[model samples]
Each structure stands twice: as structure tokens, then as C-alpha cells.
Target: MLQHWLLGSLALQNIGRRKARASLLIAAVAISSAIVFTGVVMMRSIETSMAVGFSRLGADLMVVPQNALTNITAALLTAEPTGEVLDADLLDQAHITGISRAAPQRVFRTEQSEFGGQGESVDLIGYDPGNDFTIQPWINERLGRPMQPGDVILGAARDVPLGSEIALFGKPFRVYAKLGRTGAGTHERGIFMPSAELLALVPAIREQTRKTPPMLEPRKVSGFLIELTPGATELQVRFALLSHLSGTKVVAGGSLLTGIRQGVTALLGGAISLVSMMFASTALMVSVLFSAIVTERRSELGLLKAIGAKRSQIVGMVLIEAIVATGGGGLCGVVFGMLLLRLFERSLVYYLTEIGVPFLWLDRMDTVLVAAACILGAGLIGAIGALTPAWRSSRHDPYDLIRGEG
Candidate 1:
């Protein structure tokens, strides 16, 4: 242990002597370590964000009419989907299944919305107040009260605040409450109302047909949301719903979360790999530079041998010098890497949130990993850099040094 300690101290001294070269080698390893750490965290954070986003569906088993899966997926993923009408009775049957709570929600759109600072076309969804709040805890009352007819909730609403009046079609809607930021959602840019009020916006189908080509079918409730009972497996419930409720899809809440995580992981992995490769190439360069330095120091090494330093001790000293240089560079790299990750998160928060993905701040585990990789990498580079020099010097004889004098 004492021998190793001496060797390490020597390494530090050598690195301190040539600070610039040491710094560059450390930079190479530190950068690589940071890339690995950032990639792992990004993959994890995005996956969690995606799962949360999918669960926003408000229903465990969405009982849309046949062929409406794409529409529902659209609403969940992009907040864009054409409206569909499905039988409302399906909600009751799902509830009676005794395995969970089922609530139905109706979705539609107003021809124009006052949400956009000015009137613009906007989508709207109406839900049963009692059950709706369970899934969307984020929908808590921020101002006037929980949702009611003509009461709409807004997202951060960009620069727009709550308490604004919105006009939808010919009806005046009040933005009585504002919703907490839910990353991104269909409702982020939409209005909410009682289904009855939304239905009132459209004339009776027969009445409309008389005037035009019956632009739309008589509107029915759009879908149902089911909450599984405790211990209920989401996958089992999903498939069970399919067996009973023909022509509808039961999307597993878990699967939705998994897909999002995997997608983000794939993206992050590719990017991180590319960045790591850059650092890796830098490390290779450091190795070559150090190797060349070791070669040039051969005479000095021979002189040390002539003074009676053992080959093992000489090798240990060379390694110590290389380690000090690399470790210092690595430590600096770690500090820079954290800053880079934070800067990246800040710059891409909006874009990541848009797709129900999040760029999480680096966590403790991430930091540990980054540091470990850098330290290990630095040690590796230094040791490898010293190998050839140590081997060459170990073979030197006192005769060679004496011969030089002759």
C-alpha cells in the first residue's frame, strides 16, 4: 500500500509539472463519461414522461366505435383526431364488471375558439365531472371552480392567463379556471364544457339534414375511461375488454408508457453514442501523444535505472505520472459535462414536453456514473500510455548509461 501510495504521489507531481498535456487527456475521458451518463438519464426521463402523457387518456379502456383507434391514438399523441360518436351504454356495462370504475367522456370541437388570444378553431372534450377529476388531478381548480358548463380551463396558455372570455361557435365561454401545466395535451390548447352544452352547439341531425347534406351524424358520446381495481392487471383487463367489447381497443396504460420510454431511449442512445465516439477519438489521440512523450523520455528513464531504481519501481513511477495527468483532466471534464447537460435540458424543454417527453435534470446516480467513468477512463489512458515506456526502460542496463559517458 505504501509503495502504491508513493507511486500515486509521484504521478500527481508529474501531471502537475506538465499541466496542459494532463488537462487535454483528462478532457477526453471526462467527455466520454458525461455522454454515457446523459444518455442513460435522458432515456429514463423521456420514458417516464411518455407514460404519464399516455395515462392522460382519462380512460383505461377507450370504447370508441369501430375504426376509431387511430383517432383516439391521435388525440392521445398529438391532440388531433376527428370526432366519433359511440354508444353511451357501454360505460354502464364496463362499470358493472365489478373490476373497476368506468366513466364516459364526449369529445367534439367548436368551429372557432377564443382561446388563441383571438377566435380560432379549437377541439373540445366534455367529461363526467365526478370521474374526470380522478384521472386528471392536474385539472384542479385554479380560479373560479371545477369545470361546469361554459367554464373552460387553459394550459400555461402561453402568455395568456386565465379569466378570459372565449367565444366558441356562437356561444360565449368563460375561462373560469386555469389548469396546471400538463406538458402538452389536446386540452392544452382546447376548451372544456358540459357535454349537454357541446351538443347544444350542433343542431339536431335531422334539422341539419334539411338545410344541407347532414354535415354530421347525430352526435353520441365519444368514449369511455375505465380505472382498474387494485391488483387488476392492465394487460388482462385490456384483452378482456376486447373479448367482450368488439370493435374497440383497450390500450394498456403500461404499454403506452413503455413505448414512449423506448422511443426516447433510442433517440438519446443514438445521439449519446455519437457524442461519446467523439470523446473516444480524443482519448485515442491522448494515448498516442503520451506514448510519444514516453518514448522521448527514454534517456531520462535510463539514467534513473543507472542510479539503481528497480525496474518495477520505475514502471510504477511512470504510471503514477500518467495517472495524475489524466485524472486531473477527467475531473475538469466532469464539471463541464454537468453544465452541458443542464444547458441542453434548458434549450430543449419545450420540444421534449411537446411530445410528452421530458429532459430531466441529471440525478445523483447519473452524476456518480459520469464521475466513475471519467476516473476509470483517465486511469486506463494513463496506464496504457506508460506501458511501452515502462517496458523499454525496464530493459535498460547500467552499462548503457556508463557507455554513454565513455
Candidate 2:
């Protein structure tokens, strides 16, 4: 251990003696590491943000009554409540393949006794809280517990405050949560409740309207929101649904964002290719630079070997020098990368969030791990770069090395 420490000290001193050359090597490594670190973090963060955003978009496909009126172009996130109804047990009866989860939604459109002004239609959507994927995921703010019977979630455009009582169809309901702005017609102006609660409210709705509502029929729902299993293509799932169920039309939810998702995937591939090339070039530069460094210090190494130094000792000294320089550079690069990410958050990320686009950064622990990996990778790269030249120089005759002829 003592001999190793002494060798390390000698290696550090040699680095100090050639300050300009050492600085050049460190700056080069720092540039490469900074690019690599920033690219990887940004790519991972963007991918995660995209996943969360798309998942919150409700379902991959929506199944509605065959004759139900729908604007295929506009129904991306949450489809507007269509009056046509389908059997709630439709999916169960069909036993459709590729279906991971199917959440039923019941809609009751009324303009009486309540939340909206006189004659202004309001849509009340009933969802199974346990089976819901769409409505609850967008809840930006809510009370501290799960939504219960007699509780309601309001749309973004609703002025009702949380925990406040609001009457809908002559029945009082507690405001449980509020959804974020989803830029959809129905989602921005609808009310959501559990299916059981909505089912129980059917009598009150019938009393208020003084007539029967077709959508409130027993075991009926406005639509079925379908989530597909992994490796299931939307087209394939649609075909299966059409084959099994005769009176339904499938609306693809991801159709609008498919191009954006593809573009993001292409950008990720480009970023990885760029980083790989940068690392390759950096390794080549390190090898060439170390070879020159060994050539310049031939006589000094020869004298050390002539006295008592073993080849292992010589190699260890050279490796220590390379590791220290590259590792220090990697540390500095990480700091610079952090600053870059901060700027990115303040600028582009802030703007996107303001425009309602989701953006999530890597967690602190993950950032630390990536930084540590970069430092270790830099040190390993240095050692590999210096190994060949250092070993070859050590194997030459001491007299030949001293004469600078080998």
C-alpha cells in the first residue's frame, strides 16, 4: 500500500510538471462527457414524459354504438357523450382478444335542476372508479381520500370549488376533485362520478325530467374505453373488436399523436447514435495522445526501470495519472451538465408546462447514479487508452529507451 501511494504521488507530480498537456487532455474528456451526460438524461426524461402524457390520454381505442355520431378527428383524448347506448356486458360477451382493460362509461345529458344554467345541457359521466383509467388520472387537485358515493369530479371549466356541495338533477353531491384542462369538449365541461352512484341517481333524474331517459336503462353504458395489451397493434385490436361485436365502431385514441410519437422515437435514435460516435472519437483521441505522452517521457521511464522499478509499477504510475485526469474532467462535466439541464428546465420545459404539455426530469438519485457512471466510464476509458503504449514502452530494453531509439 505504501509503495502504491508513493507511485501515485510520483504520477501526480509528473502531471503537474506538464500542466498545459494535462489541462488539454482534461478539457477534451470534459467536453465528451458533458455531451454524453446531457444527451442521455434529456432522452430518458423526454421518453418518460411522453409515456405519462400518452397514458393519461385515456384509452388506445373507444367502442361506441355503431350508429353513434362521432367526429373521428376530434375525439382523441375523451370522446363527447353520445346518446346511443350499448349493453354494459358487451365486451364480456364478445371475449375480445388483445384487450388488457375495458372501462365502461355511462353518460346522462340533462338541462334541469342544477349545475348548469336554465336550458344549458350538462353531461354527467359515470365511471367505475376501480376500472377507470381516463377520468381519475387527470385529477390535478382533490381531497385527501378516495372518491366515494355521492362525491363528484368537475371538469376544468367548472367554477365549483372542491368540497363544496352542488345539486345535480335535484340531488346534492360533494365536489371531490377537479380534472386538469384536457383540451377536449366533453372533458372540459363534464362531471364524473362512480357508475354505482350514477345508477342510484337514475330515479332522481327520472323524477326531475318527468320522463324516461334511454341512456339510464339498466345494464347500459355510453361507451367502452379499451386499453390494449403490449405488442397489440391498434389496427389488429380494431379488427378483432369489429369481428366480435356487430353494432359498435372503434375510435383510435392514439391516431392523432401517432406521428408525434414516431418523431420522438426517431429523435431518440439519433441522439444515441451521436453519443456513441462522440465516445468513439474521444477514445481514439485518448489513445493517440497517450502514445505521444509515452514517447516524450521515454528516457525518464527508462531511468526508473534501470534503477529498480518493475513493469507493473511503471504501468500503475501511468494508469494513475490517466485515471486522475479523466476522472476529474468527468466530475467537472457532470457539474456543467447539471447547469445545462437547469437552463433547459427554465426555458423550454417551463414553456411546455405552461402550455399544458407534461415534462418530467430524472429524479435526484438517478442523476447521481448517471454522474457516477460517467466518472467511472471516463476513468476506465483512460486506462484502456494508456495500456498499450505503457506496456510496449515498459517491454523495451532500458538502454534503447534511454537512448530514445525504440
Candidate 3:
């Protein structure tokens, strides 16, 4: 134990003695590890974001009026307004072969002058809270209460305060809660209210628009959101719905996101490839750096050998030095990477949204695992880099090394 302690002390002293070179090695490892760590975390986040986004969308299939298919798709995916309506009774068709759940929804446009200093037109989604699976999970988690008649929930992008009142069709509705950010989807720019409330407001809406025809009808809705039973494929449910319901079009939600998923997958694949190349180059650089360090310390190693030190002891000492440098670098790299991710999270999300990609932060366990992998991989790389140099140095003839003859 004493001998091991002394050797460790000597290794640490050598690192201190060569501060400049040690710092360079440490910095190189840190930069490489940071890149790898960031890439891993971001890739995982993108994947999770896509999954959660799909879940939040709350449907395996959507049933819309035959002529309004494209318009409804645009409304749900891009937050555009749709003025189309379908028979509310169409929701009954969801009880077909493979369907698990279905909820009716009515979407329309409403303008509020009190929001953001100027009048802004926002998409309003009226849903059946009792039968809803989509958006309800988030609402339950965030608000812990069911939505009531005159209450509204704002999407993450809208600048609204909870408990504040906003007029819709000349009636005041209190803001219930604000949702967390979900980028570039209908939820980001939507305000959700009870379908019953929206139905009640139709008369008032007609009163306000005396010269124009009413857009909303008492017993009509815009679409039906559907979920499939376990072991049931979307294709099966969609086909069944199509055959059962006339004047309606059923679309698989997965088909809507296929293009976005392909783009994100390509981006993640390229990033991983780049990170792998960077790690390889970093390992090579570490090997070269340790080789030079071993050459410089030839005399010191020789003296240790002269004092009856075994070759294994000499290798252990070099291994310790390499671990100290690389481990420290890896830790710093993790911190740096996390800081960068946090600082640029919003900007990164915005840019990806513009490019039609989904971005989200990883869960705690995933983040920790990614960080641990980066640090451990870096340490292993450093140890491997020192192996050849340590072996070669330990095998040198003590007398020749002492005489500076090799």
C-alpha cells in the first residue's frame, strides 16, 4: 500500500511538473468528449420529442369531412384555421372493429385584441373533455383538474396568464392554465375550450355576425380524433372506418409525420458519424502526446528501474497519469456540454422548428446515462493511448537509458 501510494504521488507530481503539456492533452480530450456528449444527448432528445409530440397529438387516425381532408391536416399540423364542419354524429363510427377511443373536435378562428398589444388571430380547438385522450394527459398533469365550461387553456407559444379573462364571441372566458412548450405543432398555437361551451357560443357568434352566415352549427363538429386498440394496426382501423362511414375520410396520423421523421433521422445519423470521427482523431492525438511524454521521462523511468521497480509498476504509474488527465477533462467536458445545451435550448428548438424538425430535452435518467458513457469512454481512450508508450518505456535497458545512449 505504501509503495502504491508513493508511485501515485510521483505520477501526480510529474503531471504537475508538466503543466503546459498536460493542459493541452486535457483540453483536447475535453473538446472531443464535449462534442460526443452533446451529440448523444441531442439525438436522444430529438427522438423523445418526436415520440411525445406524437402522443400529445392523441390520435392514430383522424376522420374528417371528405372535402376538408387537406384543410384539417393543415390545421392540425401547421396551426392553420379550418372553416369546415362535419356531422357530430360521425363520432359514433369510432366504435368500429379496431377502434379504442374517439373524441369530437371543432376548430375555428378567433381574434383577441388584448393579447400582445395588437389583435391576434388564434386557432381555437373545442374538444369533448369526457372522451378526450389527446391533450388530456398533459392537462391532467399540469392543471390537476378538469376543464370547465368557460375555462380555456393556452398553448405554450401564446403569451397569456392563468386566471386572466379573454373575450370570445363577446363572452368572457378565464384562462385555466398554460401548457409547456411543444414546438411547431397545433398545440403550440392553440387555445382549448370545451365543445359544449363552443356550442353554446354559436348563437352569440351569429348575433355578432348578423350580415354573414354562421360558421358553427349546434350539432356539428369539424373532425373526430381516434385511437386504436392494442394489437390493432392503423391501416386496419382506417380501412374499417372508411367502409363504415360515408362522406368521411380517415387518415393515419403516422403518415403525416413520416417525412419529418425521415429528415430528423438523417440529421441524427450524420451527427453520430461526425462524432465518431472526432473521437478517433482525439484518441490518435492522445496516443502521440503520451508517446512524447514517455520519451521525455526516459531517465526518470530508468532511475526507478535501477532502484528495483518492476515493469508493471512503471506501466501503472503512466496509466494513473493518463487517467487523471483524461478523467478531469471528461468531467469538464460534461459540464461545458450541459451549459451549452441549456443556453442554446430555445434557439436550437426554434431553428429546428423552422426546418420542420422536433427538438426536446432528455429525461433525467437518459441525460445521466449519456454523460456517464462520455466520461467513461474518454477515460478508456486515454488508458489505451498510454498502453504502448508505457510498455516500450518499461522494457528499456536501465544502463543505456541512464547513459543517454538510446
TM-score of each model, paired residue for residue: 0.46, 0.66, 0.53
Give the least accurate 10-residue stretch of model 2, judged by summed lDDT: 71-80
| Candidate 3 colliding pairs | none
Q: Model 3, 328-359: lDDT tens per residue? A: 78888998899878766858777878896656
Clashing residue pairs, backbone N/CA/C < 3 A, model 1:
11-320, 11-321, 26-329, 26-330, 47-261, 59-225, 60-226
Give one digit per residue, the lDDT tens place, for model 1 in 41-98.
5655655554444445444444555655443342232212345456667655654452
Off by over 4 Å in 3: 54-257, 345-360, 403-406
**Can you rank all candidates by lDDT, best first?**
2, 3, 1
Q: Which candidate is the best by TM-score?
A: 2
Q: What lDDT tens digits, residue by residue, belong to model 2 across residues 1-406?
A: 9989999999899889999999989988888888888878888898778767755766878989988877654334454477788998999999878787788888777778477687888988888777777787788899999777889999999988999999887789999999888777788788988888888888888888777566667788888887776556788889999998998888887654544554566778888998989988888888888889888989999999999899999889988988888888888788888889989999999999999788989888887888898888888888888989999999988888899956
Q: On a 0 to 100 scale, what is the lDDT of residue 150 in model 1?
A: 70
What overall lDDT, based on C-alpha atoms, would model 2 receive against the true structure?
A: 0.83
Better of 1 and 2 by lDDT: 2
